[model samples]
Target: MNKLLIFDLDDTIFETKSIKKESVKPIFDQLEPLLINKFGTALTAQIIPELWKYPFDFVAEKYKFDKHQNTEFARFINEHEYKLNIRTFDDFSVVENLKQEKILVTTGFSKLQHAKIHYLGIKQKFSEVYIDNILSSERVFKKGIFQSILLERKIEPQLVYIIGDNPNSELKAGFELGLHTVQVAKFGQEKSDYANYCISNFNELIPILK
Candidate 1:
C-alpha cells in the first residue's frame, strides 16, 4: 500500500539560509530601517540574526509587531523576488522520485514562497502545494491543511507521514491529528520529542516508510 507524504518546503527540502549573502543583502538593507524605526537600534540589532532562522511572522510576533508594522513588512516582502535559482538538498531526489503521493505545505508570504518554489523547479513534483500566507487575514496553518488532505483523500491517519523540520509547526500538528511525524534534521538539528522518526536525509526514510 502507498502512503501519503506531506512535506515542509523551507529547511526540509532546501536550506533557506544557504541563499548567498549578496542575494539577501538588499532585503535586509530595506528592512533594517523599518525595524529600527519600530524597535529602535538595540532591539533591531537583536532581530536581524533571527530573520533567516524563523518565519517572518514568527519573528514579528516574538517582537510584538503591531498591525501597521506587519502591514509594512508584508508589503516589502511581497514586492521582493529571489534573483538567483535555489537548490534543494542533494538527498531530496529520494523523496522526489518516491512513488507515493506527495504534497507541499509551507508557511510564508505567498510571493516569496512561490518564488522559491519557482526557482527550485519542483512545483510540478507535488500533487498539491499549499502556502499558509502569514499576511493573509484568513491564513490557515499546516494542521488544517493536513486534516483536509486526510478527509479529501479518505486516508487513515496511520497511512500518512508529515515530514518537516519544525517541532512547533508540522510535527506538533501531525501528532495532534494522529499521523506519523518525521523530522528532517538537515542541519544537525536536535531530534524533537514529537517526531516519530528523525532523519538527516531522505535516504534514512526508506525503512521507516516501508
Candidate 2:
C-alpha cells in the first residue's frame, strides 16, 4: 500500500519560538489598543501570549472576542509578514530525506503562514501545502481538509499518517479519521492519549513507518 504523510507547519516542522517575541511585538503593538478597548487591560494582556502561540480563531474564541475585535486582529496579523529568515528544527533534514508522499497542512492567518513557508524555502519539499486560513469566511479546519484529501485521493485511513504538535488539532483530527497519529514533541511535550506514536525527532519515524 502506498503511504501518505501529512505534516503541520509551525511547531511540527519548524519552531515558531524561533520568531523572537520582540520581532512580532510591533504588529501586536498596533493591535493592543483595539484588544484592550474590547476586552480590558488584564484580559488583553493574557490574550497576547496566546496570540503568539495559537491561531487567531482559537484565541478569539477562547477569549470571547467579538466580531469587530476578530476583524481588527485579523487585519493586523494577516497583513504583517516576518521579514527575517525562519529556520526549521535541526532534525528536520530527516523529514527532508523521507521518501513518503508528504503533504503540509497548517492553520494560521494566510499571509503570515505563507511568509514562513517562503522564508523556510522548503515549499518544494511537500507534494502540496495547505493553509487553513482563519481569516476566510468559511474556514475548514485541519480535519475537513484531511478528510477531503482522503476522499479525493481515495486513500485508506491505514495508509495515512498525521504528524503535528497540537493534540487538539491535527492529532485529534487524524485520530477521528482513523489515520495514524504521530505527535512531534520537539519541546519535550508530554504524550497525548490520541497519538499512536510520540516522537521528538523525525528519524524516530523510520521505525514507526516501517
Candidate 3:
C-alpha cells in the first residue's frame, strides 16, 4: 500500500519556540508600554501570557486598539515572524523524497501555517495541508481532526505515519487510529511515552522510514 507522512509544524518543521522567543516576544515587549498606557498596572502580568494565547487578536481585543494598531501589529509580526535560522530536519530533501512515495499531513491555523510554509517555500511539498480552520472544531488537541483527514481522504490506516515532537496527543491519535508513529524530541524536552519510535534528530529518521 502507498504510505502517508503527517508532520507537526511548530517544533517539527520549524523551531516554534525560537520564533516565539526572538520575534514574537519583542513585539510583545514593545506592546507592553502601550498596554500599560491603555490598561495600567494590570497590563504587565496579563499581557505576558495573553500575547501568547491568540497573540494578535487577543491583544487587539483587550486594548480596544483600532484597525491601524492591529494592522501595524500584524505587519510587525509578519515581518519578523520567521527567522529561518534552523534548517528543516528533512531540509527541502525530505519533502521532495517523500513526494515520490507518500502524502504529508499537518494541522494549524491557516494564516499562521501558511506564512511559515510560504517563507520556507515548501508549501508544494505536502500533498495536503490540514489547517485547524478546515477542521470541524477549534480545539488544540486535534486527534479527531487528524482522524477526519484520513477518513475524508480515504487513506488506509497502515499507510499513514505521524511525525512530531510531543507524542502524547499526536502519538495517541495515530496509535489509536492504527497508524505508525515517530517522535522527534524538542530542544529541552526529555523522552516521553506514546511514541513507537523516538529520536533526538531528524537525520535519525531516515532508517526508520525504510
Candidate 4:
C-alpha cells in the first residue's frame, strides 16, 4: 500500500472554480501600482500568471524595466491576496479522507502557497508540506526535493505517489525517483509524460488509493 500521497497545490487540490470571483477583484487594484510605476503602465493582469513562470529579474529585462524593479514586484506579489479564493474543487475532499499520510509537494513561494492552503481549508489535511522555492528564480525545475523527504522519513520510493497537473516538472521528478506518478490533468489536457495514471478528478484517485 502507498504510505504517502503527494499533491500539487494549484489546479490540482485547490482550484478557483468554486470561489466567488467578486471577492478576488480587489487583488488587481492592490498590485496595479507596482506594475504601473515600474513599467510606466500596467500590463494586462493576465500576464501575471506567465510572469510567475520566470524569474522577476529576467521578466524585468524582457520588459525593459529596471532589473531591481522586478524584485520589488515579486515581493509585492508574493505577499498579497493569497487568501482571496479559499475554495477547492469538489473532489478535493477525497484527499482529506484518505488513510495515507498526504504530503503537499508544490513549487512556488511558501508564504503565498501556505496562505492559500490555510484559506482553502486543506492545510490541516496534509501531514507534511514541501514547497520548491527554486521555482521562484528558475524555469526548469529538476532539483530532487523528494530526496530529502525519502531519507528523512525512510519511505521507499515505490511506496509513494505524486499527483499533479504539470507533466514536465512535477510528474517527471517523481517518476525519476521511482515513485508512482499521477497527472491530475485539467479538462482538455493532452497526455502527460511520466505519469503512471492520469485522471481529471480526485475522486478517481479514491479507487487507485484503495
Candidate 5:
C-alpha cells in the first residue's frame, strides 16, 4: 500500500506550544497597551492567556473585536516569531529518512505559516502543505481538507495517518475519516481521546511511521 502521512504544522512539526509561551512577552508589548485602552488592564490580563493559545479569529469571536483591526497585532506576532526560528523539535532527520509520503495540513493564514515554513527550511519536507483560512469551523475545515485530499489523490483512508497536536482539529478529523490518528503531546501529558497513538515528542514518530 502507498502510505500517505499527514502532519499538522503548528505544534506538530514546529514547536508551537513553547513558541507561543516565548512569544507572549513580545506579543504583549506590542498589543497590550491597545488592549488596556479598550478592555482595561484587568480584563486584558484575563484574556491574553486564552488569546495566546489559538488564532486571532478565535480572539475576534470571543471578544467581539474586529478581525481587520488585528492585522498589525497579528503581523507583529508572525514577524517576531519568525526571528525566533522555533524550528522542528526533533532534528527532522527522522522525517527526511522516512520512506512514507507526507503532507502538512494546518489551520492558519497562509502568509505567517508560509513564512515560518520558509525560514525553518522545511518547505521540502512535505509533498503538499495546506494552510487554510478556516470557514465554518476549524474542525470542519480540517475534515474537509482531509476528505478532499483523499479524493484528489485517490488515497485509501486506512493507509493514511494524520498527525497533530490539536486533537479536536487534526486528530479527530483523521479518525472520523477512518485514517490512523497520532497525537503529539508535550512531555508527560495524557494522550487525547481522539488519538489512536500518542507521543511526547516528534522524534517518537519515526519508529511508528517507519
Candidate 6:
C-alpha cells in the first residue's frame, strides 16, 4: 500500500518556543503595560496566563475587547510581529521527500498557522493542510483531528503514519486508527506510551522512512 505521512506543526516541524520567545512574547510584554493600566497590575498578571491558554476569539469574548482591537492584536502577533525561526532538520527533508504522500496536520488558528507556514515557505511541501476551525477546538486533541483527517482524505488506517514530538495525543490517534507512529524527540522532551518507534532527531527518520 502507498504510505501517507502526517505531521504536527508546532515543535514537531518547527520550534515554536523560539517564535514564542521572540515574537509572541513581546506582544505579551506590550500588553502587560496596557493591561496594568486598565485592569491593575495584580489583575493583569492573574489574567495574562489564562489569556494565553484561551484562543484569541475566546480571549476577546471573555475580555470584551472590540473586534477592531482583536483584529489588530491578531495582525500584530501573526503578520508584523512574529518571526519564524524554522530549522528544517535532516528528518524534515526525509519527510519532505515524501511530499507526494505527506500531509501537514496542525490544530490552531488558521490564519496564524498559515502565516507561519507561508513564512517558512513550506506550504508547497504538504499535500494537504488540516487546520482547526475556530468554532470547534477538537483539533487540539490529536485523535479527534486525526479521525477527521482520515474521513476527509479517505485514507486507510494501515497506510498512514503520524510523526511528531510529543507522542501523547499523536500516538493515541495513530493507535486508535491503527496507523504506524513515529516519535521524534530531538528536543529531548519525555513522551508517553503509544510511540511505536522513538528516534531522537530528524536524521534518524531518513533511514526509518526508507
Every model's TM-score: 0.94, 0.95, 0.65, 0.75, 0.79, 0.70
RMSD of each: 1.4, 1.4, 5.7, 4.1, 3.5, 4.8
lDDT for each candidate structure: 0.88, 0.89, 0.63, 0.70, 0.76, 0.69
Candidate 5 local lDDT, 1-210, one digit each (tens)? 788989888866666665545534776787877778888999889878877777767776789765444765766656664444467766467666778888988787556677778877887978998877643234348888899999998988988989888876888888888999988885565788889899876578777765
Decoy 4 TM-score against native: 0.75
lDDT of 4 by residue, 1-210 (tens): 447888888788766344554544455465567676654553645455545455333455566755355455556556566546567877877778888888887765556666777788776788877777633554444336677778888888888888888776778898888988988886658767788998987788878776
Candidate of highest lDDT: 2
Tens-digit lDDT string for candidate 2 (1-210):
789999999899898878878667878998889888887899888988888877777888887888888787777776776685578889989998988999999998888888889888989999999999977888878999998999999989999999999999999999999999999998899999889999999989999998
lDDT of 1 at 29: 86
Give one digit per residue, the lDDT tens place, for model 6 in 95-210.
Answer: 66553477887756566787778877888888787775443424356677788777987878877889877564566778768888888787776655778777777667666666
Off by over 4 Å in 5: 17-30, 67-82, 134-140, 201-203
Model 3: per-residue Cα lDDT over 68-164, one tens digit each:
5555555555465545444454554654665434444455445556666776677677766665432223544457767787788798887777887
Q: Which of the two candidates, 2 or 4, achieves a greater TM-score against the reference?
A: 2
Give the range where candidate 2 is weakest over 10 consecutive residues by summed lDDT.
Answer: 77-86
Each prediction's number of clashing residue pairs: 0, 0, 0, 0, 0, 1
lDDT of 1 by residue, 103-200 (tens): 99998888888888988989999999999888887866888888888889899999999999999999999999999999999889888988999999
- TM-score head-to-head 2 vs 3, winner: 2
